[model samples]
Target: MNIKLIHSKVNAVLKAASPITLPVDIESIAKKRGLDVLPYELGPDVSGLLAIKDGKGTIGYNSTETRVRRRFTIAHELGHYELHKEKSDLFVDKQFIYRSQNSPITVDHQIMEHEANYFASCILMPTDQVRKELEKMDIDLVSEEGIKHLAKVFEVSTTAMSLRIDKLGFF
Candidate 1:
């Protein structure tokens, strides 16, 4: 899908839920959405997948990643569910997605990954609320610690927060 469509869907969800955050139990969300989420061993080449069978939906993640990383992975797959389910049967992300950002990949893959990242960020840190929270700080917006704090508040990795903040033109 197009960015506009993805943006609208994410934005609508954000508007409906004013403040979002990570460390969120995405498994619960999946269950609520009629999807089952299970932990399984995905090899080094793959991070996760959105699987559906017999009219049921599910997500599978690598067992080796840290809890925070697993949460992000689930959210990323959830992004595919909300935004790209109609286009592809699966989204097999690689390990160290931050590195993948610099690798040679197809434009379509890049776009989809970026959209999933965007969706993850918005779900983890609702822009409206983050803006309000940041108003109390007088520090440089792009500084390392500033981004780190944002990551802490959102319970996402520093890389994810930095990417989201950069995309928002906040620094």
Candidate 2:
């Protein structure tokens, strides 16, 4: 999948749902899309899953995970719902192993997972918002404290925020 295309798709969704406030609400967005967000005690390995039945969609995330993680999981499931729902009615996503940009995505499942991760990153830490936040802060992206502060502002895990910043070429 093309990274630019995924970014554009995320941008389109954001544009249609204009006036999105900071710390994007994953559950609210899912609800607006007519998808129910549910909490479930899924096993440790399973982060979340999406299911569409009878023309309705539901996203289930592991209740035991941290709030930030649950947020990302919901966004990831939303990605699958938006992009691959036509491919299958059910999508069960496990712990995502971060793949380097140059890694080979040879399988269909890997491709879809990669796209979903990209989608999650884009929506959770929008490029424009991130840039604006960085402009207001006088911290270095390479510093751990700076990453933590940014993560708190974005309501995401520090690791997720770091990856997002790196992907956006901020560091």
**Displacement of the residue 135 alpha carbon in candidate 2, Å:** 0.3
Residue 133 displacement (Å), model 1: 2.3
Clashing pairs in 1: none
Best by TM-score: 2
TM-scores, all candidates, are 0.79, 0.90
For model 1, residues 44-135, the per-residue Cα lDDT tens digits are: 76778887556566889888887768878887888878887777777777765534557676778778887886777666666665676578
Number of the top candidate by lDDT?
2
List runs of model 2 lying over 4 Å from the truth.
Answer: 96-106
TM-score of 1: 0.79
**Backbone N/Cα/C clashes per model:** 0, 0
Task: Find the 10 residues in a row with the least total lDDT in model 2.
Answer: 96-105
Could you tell me the TM-score of candidate 2?
Answer: 0.90
Candidate-wise lDDT, in order: 0.73, 0.87
Clashes of 2: 0
